[model samples]
Target chain A: MSATATIYLLTAAAVFGIGVYGLLQARQILRQLLAINLMGGATFLLLITLGGGADGPPDPVPQAMVLTGIVIAVSATAFALALLVKLQDATGSSDLDPPDAE
Target chain B: MIALAMDAIIAIGLVWLALRTVRGANVFSAIIMFIVFGLIMSLAWARLHAPDLALAEAAIGAGITGALLLVTWRRLQVLEGSVPQVGAETRSLWLTLPTGLAAALLIAGLGWVALSLPAEPATAGELAWQRLPEMGVSNPVTGVLLGFRAYDTLLEMGVLLAAWLGAQVVASEHRPGALPGPAHEEVPLVGALLSLVVPISLLVAVYLLQAGGSAPGGAFQGGAVLAAGGVLLCLTGRLEAADQASLIERVVLILGLAVFSGVGLVMLPLGEPMLAMPGVWAIYLIETALLLSIALTLVLLFAAAPGLRRRL
Candidate 1:
C-alpha cells in the first residue's frame, strides 16, 4: 500500500476506535449521534482508501457508495435530531435517560 | 513531499478533531469541532483524487449536517432552557482498562488486515471503469451511481424522502413557525446579500447539476447547494414554515423517486434492462428530478417543517 493509503487506513482504525469509545461514554443523544457520525466517517475513509492506490484514480464504485453513504448519514442524522427534539419536548430531557440515571 | 505532509496533517487533524467532537468541554464546542472536522475531511477527499466525494462532503456532510445539528441544538436549548451535560459515564478501571485494550487490539487487527489484503486484479471497480464508456456517462462515478448502481441511488432517495416524512410524523405540532433560526432583523444589506447569494447559489446548483454528468458535481452536491440557498432564506426570515405542504411542494418532494423509477421500469417493456440509462438525456432528466427532490427534502429537513413559504 502507498504511504498515503497506510496513513489513512490506520487513521480510520483509530478514529473508529475513538468513535466506539465516544459512543460508550456519551451521556446525551446528540453526543451519541456525533459519535455515530464519527464512526461512519471512519468507515467511509477505510472503504475509499482500500478502493484505490496512490498511483491512479480511485474506484468509482466506492466513491459512489461513499457519496450515497454521506447523503444517508445526513438524512438519518437529521431525522435523529428531529426525534431528539421531540424527545426533549415530550419527556423534558435530552439525555437518553434522565440525567439522574446511574 | 508536500503532498505527504498535507496528508499527514489532515489525518492528524481528523483524529484530534474527532476526539474533541465527541468529548469536548461542552456539546456546543464538540459540534463546532465536528463541523471543522468535516471541512478537513473534504480536504482528505480531494487529496485522495475523489473530487466528486469532496464536493459532496463539503456541501452535504459539513454544510447541511452542521446546520441541522446547530438548529437541533438551538431547539433543545429553547425547550429546556439548558441541555444537561452529564460527564462521561463513570466505570471501574478494571472494566475500562480491559475494554480499552480490546479496542486497541481490534483496531490494530482491522488496520493490519485492511492494509495487508491483496488487491484483486479484476475487481468491480475495474469493471465499472471499463464499462464506463458503454454506460453513457463520461464520469465513472456518475456512471456507477446512475447507471451501474441505479438501485442504490433510488434507495438513497427513498431514505432521504422517508427521513423527511419521518421527521414530520415525529415532530411536535406545537411549533408551527420554523424552528427558530438566529434572530435577524431585516437589515437592508441582508436583502442585498440575499439577492446576490441566493441567485448565485441557484446558478451554481444548476451548473453543478449540468457538470455532474461529465465531471465531479452531481444531484447530491447541487441539491445541497440549493438547500443552502433555502437555508439562507430561512435564516434571514424570507421564508416561514407552513402547517401543511403545498401541492407543488409535495409533488417536487416525490419527483426524484417517481421520475427515476418511471424511467427505469419503462425500460423493461422495451426489452432493455431495468435502470439502464437509455441515453445521457435520461441521466440529465433523472438528475434534475433528483436535484429538485433532494434540495427540497434537505431544506425541509433543515427547516424541520412540513413545508415552507415566502414570508409575505
Candidate 2:
C-alpha cells in the first residue's frame, strides 16, 4: 500500500474505534444513529482506500458500491427517524429501553 | 507533500468531529457536528479521486440526512417540550476500559491487514475498467452502477421504496401540516427566493443527470439536489400534506422503480441479461425516471407526509 492508502487505512481503523465507543455509550436512539453512521463512513473509507490509492485510475467498483451504500444509509436513516418521531408521539419518550426497566 | 498535508488535516477533522458528535451531551449540537463531519468526508472523497462519491456525500450524506435529523429533533421537541435522552454519561470504567482495549486491538489487526494488501493486485476493478467502453458510458463509476452492477442498483431502489413504505406504515398519524412548515404560505421574500433557487436547482439537477454519462454526476446526486428544492417549498409552507396521494405524486414516487424493473423484465423476453442497458440512450432514460422517483421519495420522507399538495 502507498502512503495515502496507509494514512487512510489507519484513519479508518481509528474512526471505527471511536464509533464503537460512541455506540456503546449512547442510550439515545439519535446518538446511536450518529455513531452507527460514523462506523458506516469508516467502512466506506476503508473500502475505497483499499480499492485504489490517490494516483492512477481509481477503482469504479468500490465507488459504485459506496454510492449505493450512501443512498441506502439515507433511506435507513429516514425510516429510523420516522420510528423515533412516532415513538415520541405515542409514549412521549424516545428512549430505547423500557419504562419498567428503570 | 501538500496532498499529504491535506489528507492528514481531513483525517484528523473527521475523527475529531466524530468524537464531538458522540460525546456531546447536547443532542442538537451533536447532530450538527455529524453533519459537518459529513461535509469533511466529502472533501476526503474528492481527495481520493472519487468525484462522484464527493457529490453523493455532499448532497445525500450531509444535505438530506442533516435535514432529516433536524426535522426529527423538532418533532421530538414539540412532543416532549424538551429532548429526551437515556444512558449513562459514560459506561462504567470496567466496561469502558475493556471496550477500549478491544477496539484498539481489533483496529491494530485490521490496520496491519490493510497495510499488507498487494499494491497492484488484479481485481474486478481492472476488468470493469477494460469493458467500460462497451457499457455505453464514458464514466466508469456510472457505467458500473448503471450497467455492470445494475442488479445492486435495482435492489437499492427497492430498498429505498421499502423504507418509505415502512415509515408510512409505522407513522402514528397522517396529520397534515404537522411538520414545522411556516403557518402562512405567503411569507415575503420566500417567493423571490424560490423563484431563484428552484430554477437553479432544476437546471443543476438536469445538468447532473446529463453529465452522469460522462462525468461525476448521476441520478442519485441529481435527485438529492432536486429533492432540496421540494424541501425548500415544503419548509416555507408552499407544499402542504394531503390525506391521499394525488395521481401525479403517486406516479412520480414509483417512476424510478417501475422504469428500472420494467426495462429489466422486458429485456428478459429478448434473452438479454436482466437490467442490461439496451444502449446508451436507455441509461439516460432510466436515470431520468430514477431522478424523479428519488427526488419525490426524499421530499416525501422529509415532509413526513402521506401525500403533498401545492398551496397556491
Candidate 3:
C-alpha cells in the first residue's frame, strides 16, 4: 500500500475501535447514535482505502457503494433520532436503562 | 512531503475527533466533535481523489446529519427542561475488557487483510471504466450508480422513502415545526442572507445535476445541496411543517423511484433488460427525478414532518 493509504487504513482501524467502545459504553441513546455513525464512517474509509492501489484511478464500485452507504446512514440516523424523541416523550428519559434500574 | 504531512494531520484529527465524540463528558460537545470529524473526513476524501464522495460527505454526512443531531439534542433538552449531562455509566470491567479486546483484534485483522491484498487485483472499477462508453456517462461513479448498479440505487431510494415513512409513524402525535433560529425573523440582513444563499444553492444543485453526466456531481449530491436550501429555509422560518403533505410535495417525494423504475420496467417489454435506460435523455430524466425525490425526502427527514408549507 502507498504511504498515504497505509496511514489512513491504520486510522480507520483506530476509529473503528473507538466506535466499538462508544457503542458499548454510551448510556444515552443519542450518544450511541453518534457512535454508530462513527463506526459507519470508519467502515467507509476502510473500504475506500482497500479499493485504492499505488497508482491509477481508485475503484469506482466502492466509491458508489460508499456514497449509497452515506445516504443510508443518514436515513437510519434520522429515523433513530425520531424514535429517540418519541421514547423520551413516552418514558421521560433518553437513557436506555430505566432510572430505577440504575 | 507537504502532502504526506497534510494526510498525517487529517488522519490524526479524524482519530482524535472520533475518540472525543465517543467519550466526551457532554452529549452536545460530542455531537459537535462528530460534525467536525465529518468535515475532516471530506477533506480526506478529496485527498484520496474521490471528489464525489467528498461532496456527499460534506453535504450529507456533516451538513444534514449535524443539523439533525443538534435539532434532536435541543428537543431532548426541551423535553427534560434542562441540559442533560451524559456522563459515563459504570459497567463491569470483565465484560468491557473482553469486548474492547475483541474489537481490537477485529481491527488488527482487517488492517492486515487490507494491506496484504494483491497490488492490482482485478476490481469492478476496472470493468466499469472499460465499459463506460456503453453507459453514456463520463464519470465512472455516476456510470456505475445509474448504469451497472442501478439495482442498488433503486433499492437505496426505497430505503430513503421507508425511513421518512418510519419517522412519521414514530412521531405521529407530535407535529414538528420550523427549527428555532433567531427569535425574530425581522433581524436585519436575514432577508439578504436568505435571498443570496437560497438562490445560489438552487443554482448549484441544478448545475450539479447537469454536470453529473461528465463530472464529479450526481443526483445524490445535487439533491443534498437542494435539501440544504430547504433546510435553510426551514431554519429561517420561511417554511413551516404542515399537518399534511401538499399534493405537489407528495408527487415529488415519489418522483425519483417512480420514474426510475417506471422507465426501467418499461424497457423490459421492449426486449431490453430491466432498468436499462435507453439513452442519454433517459439518464437525465431519471437523474432529475432522483434529484427532486432525494432533496424532498432529506428535507422532510430533517423537518421530521409529514409535509411543509410557506410560513405566513
Candidate 4:
C-alpha cells in the first residue's frame, strides 16, 4: 500500500510488457537476447520488492533466490551470446529467420 | 519514510529503464540502458536490506552481463549493412494490452497479499536464524548460501562453470580485436588512478569475503571488486588477453570451486556433511578461493579473451 511499493511493482510490470514487446518486434538475434535479459531484470525487481517489508528484515528467501538467479542469468546470457556468434559465423545471416513468421 | 520514498523512486526508474532497453529503437543503446538498469537495481537491493543480492546483481547482472552483450553486439557488427533478423511475432492488442494489464494486476495483487500476511511463528527465516550460531556466521543470508541452502550455491557455481565451458566450445577462433592496447609509457593521471583504485578494490574484495561471515560482504562482492580492478587494467590497456590461459590464471579460475568441492568430498569419508566446512577457517578459505575464481572468470569473460596477461 506504500507509494514506493506501488511504484516498484508498476515499473516491473511495464518492464515485463516491454520485454514481451521486444520479443515480438526484434529482428536481430542479439536484440532478442537483450529483450530476454530485460525481462529477467524485471523479474528480479519484482522479487526484491515483494520480499521487502513495511518494518522488518526483507524476506531472505527471495533475496537468496535472486542472487542465484543473477548468476544463472549471466551464465546463460554468456553462453547464448557465444552461440549467437557461432550461429552467425556458420550462417551468413545474424538474423536466423525473417520476422514474418511467428 | 524518506528512505522508503527514495528507494521506491529509484526502483521505478530502474524498471522504466528496463522497458526502454527492451523497446529502444537502437540495439546498442538498449544494451547500455540495460546495464544502467542493472546498476540501479543493485542500489535497490541495498535499500531493501539484501546486500548479498546487491553485490551479486551488480557483478553478474550489470558487470558480466554487460560485457557479454557488448561482445555479441560487436560480433554482429561484423556483418555490415544488413540488419540482424529479429523475431517478428507481433501480439495483437487484445493479446498484448490484456497481458500487460493482467501482469500489472497480478503483481499488485501479490504485493498486497504479501504485505497483509501476518508475521507468524515457525517461519523458515526463524529456523535459519536459530541455526546461524551452528553455521559460525552472523549473517543469515550467508548461512543460507553456505550453510543451510548450500546446495543451491554449489549448483549455482556449477552453472557458472558450465556456462564458461559452453562459451569455450562456441568461441570464435578469430579473436576479437582488443580495443585498448597497452601503453609502454604510463599516461598522466591514468597510472595514478590505477594505483589508487586497484589496491582499494583488492582490499575491499578481501574485506568483503572476510566480513561475509558477519556482514553483507561475501565471495561475490569480493570477486566483483577484484574484477573491477581487472576491468580497470583492461580499460587502461594495461592488461592483454592471451591465446592460452597461463598457469597462474588457470589456478585462480579453478581455485574456488576446487577448494569447495575438495573440502566437501574429503569430508565425506570423515563422516561430515557434504560441503559442511569444519570451522570459520574453512569458510574463509573456501570463500577466498571462490572469490578469486569468480573474479578471474568474470574478468576473462569481459575481455572475451581466453587468457589474461600482463602487458610487457
Top-DockQ candidate index? 2
How many clashing pairs does model 1 include?
A: 0
Q: Which stretches of candidate 2 lie over 4 Å from their true place?
A: A97-101, B82-98, B119-122, B174-177, B183-187
Give candidate 4 regions above 4 Å deviation.
A1-7, A52-54, A96-102, B78-122, B176-186
RMSD of 3: 2.2
* DockQ of candidate model 3: 0.66
Per-residue C-alpha lDDT of model 4 across residues B1-312, encoded as one tens digit per residue: 788678667866876786677566677888899889888988877776777887877877887788778866766676433664554433346666765666566656655655565544436676777778997888878777777777787787778777777777777787543334643666798989999999999998889898998988788778878988987888688888788888998788778778888877777888987888788787787888888888888787767677888777
By summed lDDT, which 10 consecutive residues of candidate 1 chain B come out lowest?
A: B82-91
Any residue pairs clashing in model 4, and if so which?
A26-B86, A27-B85, A27-B86, A28-B85, A28-B86, A95-B85, B256-B289, B256-B290
Candidate 1 positional error at B282, Å: 0.5
Chain A TM-score of each candidate structure, as shown: 0.93, 0.90, 0.94, 0.88
Q: Give each model a TM-score.
A: 0.95, 0.94, 0.94, 0.85
Whole-model lDDT, model 4: 0.74
True contacts kept of 2: 0.80
Q: Candidate 1 regions off by >4 Å?
A: B82-102
True contacts kept of each: 0.75, 0.80, 0.73, 0.56
| Native contacts kept (model 3) | 0.73
lDDT of 2 by residue, B199-263 (tens): 99999999999999999999999999999998988898889877778899889888998998888
Alpha-carbon local distance difference test for all models: 0.88, 0.87, 0.88, 0.74
* Model 1 interface CAPRI class: medium
TM-score winner among the candidates?
Answer: 1
- Candidate that beats the other on TM-score, 3 or 4, i.e. the better one: 3
